[model samples]
Target: MIKRLVLLAVFVGGILFTSSSQNIVMDKSNVEFRVANLGANTVKGKFTGMTGNVTFDPKNIAKASFDVCIDATSINTRMKKRDTALKGPKYFDIARYPEICFASKTVSRTGMNYKVIGSLSMHGVKKEVEIIFNSSRNTLTGKLKVNRLDYKIGPKSGVFVGKQVDITITCVVE
Candidate 1:
């Protein structure tokens, strides 16, 4: 009886540690985006105040996952007027949808990095996206492309802003 109890405890502990949740280093985490304007110039911006829960284990690749969100109102383009405009109805519409969130559905190994297939929710739209990330040390850096038109991100099309947006997400978790 004593041996069976000890074995059960060991198995439970192993299950718990197999996929443990980690805290995001908020100060060191952020999301960046880039969009081409008029086919000539590129407009770049970043969003801060990101928070997330991450469970990652390199040895257990299939068990790793990420659930994260970035404050949409935190968008900064280095121009005050442009930032405010982007927060309005035609762009991010921060008043209604204040958060851009991603929840992992599946994780798979892809070369030296990993591919995270997930649902990206923003601007009241939810879409499946694949984020390929390279883990180094304690940080996870992921990148993906978002279609602005598909997400209803902007009112203007290629005339003023490009349809595709480049996004990069960085997180350091403990």
Candidate 2:
């Protein structure tokens, strides 16, 4: 009886250990981004077509990983003319770069939050950026803003209508 009980405990413990290391499947529907442009006025928008995978271990950040890709052509600014111009070659150039991507290289724990460093690719240019996110075993979400001029998306203007752009992302994993 003693031996049987010991064996049962060992088997249950093994199951738990293996389950934690298994690849976590994050639901794609839980992911989204909000864009806000704060300049002469506050212009807010949102984007769909968010697709990504996240394999994370709360105990060990080195083992944590995430990859997200956004469809550039799905950008919506609520203005038909501005949206058309945004997809032009001078801006996002959807013909040449149809996707905006992010792949994390490192993650640092900060209490209940985490700082993720990754490469953000847009307009065929990749740049390293750090974003802070609230991470838990069940969910991870964050926000970031990128300027159009930083990636050379649009031409310079004396009186800029919009300059800063904000992005927010949220996700859930099971």
Candidate 3:
């Protein structure tokens, strides 16, 4: 029993020493999002407000953790009328759900990026999704494209705007 206990303690200590944790560092100047109206050459709008954190251990991705949030009201399509409409119940419903969030449950390293399995909550609904992201000391960027309809997001179009929306987030790892 003593030998086993000692071995286990050493193993746990080694893991803690090998892994590193990081925090989310937004550039504040480099955050944006674009939404389209489909088939139209014109892209609808963009969003501004953003904040989050990312913890990682490249050598040990299993030790990684992440949480991100975006301000729903910050959405801007260059038109106040359209932006306001987006915040309504038909779309984001900002009053009922002011923030879109993600919390990672597991992290696995694959190729050049890490695959994160997490719960994404938006408009008062939560779903599991995977986010592929690359993390380095200089910068960490994550790009995940998910359909609004998957989260029961409003009456975009029965035609299906590709059934997937592209989302990309870039931030510094602190």
Candidate 4:
């Protein structure tokens, strides 16, 4: 009947839309950062426990959106002492603010890649940041530089830990 045909079309459209957007697979995703440790060496770390929703369709970039949150206490530098300090009051202060989040305001294509302008909230401070990323199949990789001082991650006047932190995100959606 005509009514059944309409219902079938609607159901198929819904399924197609749902298939385009995906939730990040935490076990397969990685968020890593690198920062200069004093005048000695570079400290590399990674955070686990990321949760997010991503809606991306190359043909419909106007409707793309990204929203993600990383667990603040999940910082792991592979060095217990450093990780503990970073979780303390002078740094992330995870006891107070336990999440680092980002919500995109805009997403646009640049050449073969895309850039997302969003508000990155961390260490109890929120700042606007731009992330450049590449998408291939079911994976997305993004990179951005974050100024620790801007987020109050460490002492205001000290440079024991470099201010600029390079963060890379590799996410697989399912």
Candidate 5:
């Protein structure tokens, strides 16, 4: 009887562990960004479509991983004309690159949060970036800075737009 109870307990523990690291829930998540326009005014926007898988275990940071993608065509800035122009060749060029993606290469715990080192592919360019984030039971919040020129998303000249873009990501996983 004692042996059987121990086996059952072990099995239940294994099931719980596996389930926690498999699927990530993104139903309440958001990906947003901010950049300065030609007149030095801040322009804020968000991508409505996002999908991702995360295998995160706070206890086993070494095995954690993340793969996420955002729809480039879903950019919304509350300005019809500006939004249209962003989808054109001078900006996102959604026709040629419909998705912006990121895949983690490594994950390490920082002071109180964590850092994800990964590859960010956008506008036909792939570059390594570090994202710092904090996670709760099933939610993760993070931010990173990206240079628009690095991804070739816009012209090299900063006359019309700032070179640096600030991005924030909030994701929840089941």
Candidate 6:
């Protein structure tokens, strides 16, 4: 009889742990990027709109998953001309692909943080990527580097624009 009680308690505890996952708070989240332009000059920008759902439970890391989308048309660099060019065919082509998305397939612990293996889709191209992030309470912060040419984001001869882009993301889960 004592063994049965202990087994029941453990099963209930497992359920409670998994149910602790939360949804992401979009208004409090941010996604931004940095890249180099001509003359080794740097340009920084951000996407103004984002929506996503997050299921995160540190104790149950295997069940955690993230499916997020950012508005491609919301790219802003504080410069009207540059923003316009970024939405054109040579860059994001927002008219054709209006959203950039990431959906996680697996989540695993890495040291004190976590690593998520996921599929990132942008500009009509999809690629597998790894995202490393740290979580504390309801907040998460992470960064990843990607090459623009891998997604056909820019011209093959990117002499004026750098091929590598660094991206950062921060969010609060409710």
- TM per prediction: 0.89, 0.74, 0.75, 0.88, 0.87, 0.86
Q: What lDDT score belongs to each candidate, Candidate 1 first? A: 0.91, 0.70, 0.71, 0.88, 0.87, 0.87
Give lDDT tens digits, candidate 2, residues 31-70.
Answer: 2433334344665554556677676666667777778777
Candidate 4's displacement at residue 143, Å, is 0.5
User: On residues 3-104, what C-alpha lDDT tens digit does candidate 4 reach at each position?
Assistant: 999999999886676546687899888789998877588999998788988887776788888899888899999989989999999999999989899899
Which segments of model 4 are wrong by more than 4 Å?
A: 1-20
lDDT of 1 by residue, 1-174 (tens): 999999999998866754698789988999999999888999999999888789998888777888899999999999999999999999989999999999999998888989999999999999999999998988899999988988888865577899989999999886
Cα RMSD (Å) between model 2 and the true structure?
Answer: 4.5
Ranked by TM-score from best down, the candidates are: 1, 4, 5, 6, 3, 2
User: Which sections of candidate 6 miss by over 4 Å?
Assistant: 1-21
Q: What is the lDDT for 94 in model 2?
A: 91
What is the per-residue lDDT of model 5 for residues 40-115, given as tens digits with 9 covering 90 to 100?
6999999866787788877778788889988899899999999999999999999999999989999999999999
Model 4 residue 138 CA deviation (Å) reads 1.0
Query: Which regions of candidate 2 deviate over 4 angstroms?
Result: 1-38
Sliding window of 10 residues with minimal summed lDDT for model 3: 26-35
Better of 4 and 6 by TM-score: 4
2 versus 3: better lDDT goes to:
3
Candidate 1 runs further than 4 Å off = 1-18
TM-score of 2: 0.74
Which residue pairs collide in model 6, if any? none
Candidate 2: clashing residue pairs, number: 0
